[model samples]
Target: MAEPTGAAAPGFELPLLLFAGFRSIIDDLHRELAEQGHPEVRPAYGYALQAVGRDGATASEIGRRLGVSKQAAGKTVDRLERLGYVERADDPQDGRRKLVRLSPRGIDVLVRSAEGFDRLRAAWVRALGAERVAALESDLRTMASADAFRLDATSWFNG
Candidate 1:
């Protein structure tokens, strides 16, 4: 029997496919964010921003969340501060440490990012239908919850 001309080979890996899909989504989201007056924030920066959160977080905490060294997290914070997306203030409880929080501009960026994600998801829903999208989301969440799939920003950020 001959192989089908256009079909994928049996050696295709699901992880590769998932990575490609994720990259595509990030690209689209980045483009959307740029279109909405929010640019210069890469996916890695987005992850760092998320680690900072709303209330605030210490550089050490962000480092732990991002799976990077404290110095690396400080560099990320430095870049974000230079970009006017984050501010560091003295920690009230500890005079020696500083708390990192998103600036007003950072909040705007996050809002725009959310809008971009919504737009991307909406497009996917249009193509795949809401039911399929929902199922896919559920499955992804389930897989993500597995202990084997640890969330490590350093792995994703290549740092």
Candidate 2:
């Protein structure tokens, strides 16, 4: 490995640092989820579940939301169904449409994810100080794109 030259990091380091922070938080969250009885949980599941939402969505809708093909969304739905995270229901408005709704287990994972994120934020507060964290968040909010919180990022990244 090369030693540090004591020079400022390359421009690429900015995005790398941001991605590393995201990866660290996600890794931590998955570890907690596995320990909390969601051992099969994966990041893709979280994104798909979010796309499904409590109101439910069809595979086509999910595909659009996820920025993936319908077949890809269907495959994801198949896995989620087998894992008991979601169930298919006949759409009331459209007889031919099947809505993929979250099962109780699916809700549990979302709940747990929220709690885990809260705990992680608290840890960040402790490590970086609340004000610094808050400022960082503020700066990110200002710098981030309007669609930064969109659910298609994972699929977009993969593509």
Candidate 2 lDDT tens digits, 65-159: 99999999999999999999999999999999999999999999999999999999999999999999999999999999888998898888888
Query: What ranges in model 1 sit over 4 Å off?
Result: 1-11, 147-151, 156-159
The candidate that wins on lDDT is 2
In model 1, the clashing pairs are none
TM-score of 2: 0.94
RMSD values for the candidates in order, in angstroms, are 3.4, 2.0
lDDT of each: 0.85, 0.94
Question: Residue pairs in steric clash, candidate 2?
Answer: none
Listed in order, each prediction's TM-score against the native is 0.85, 0.94
lDDT of the structure predicted as candidate 2: 0.94
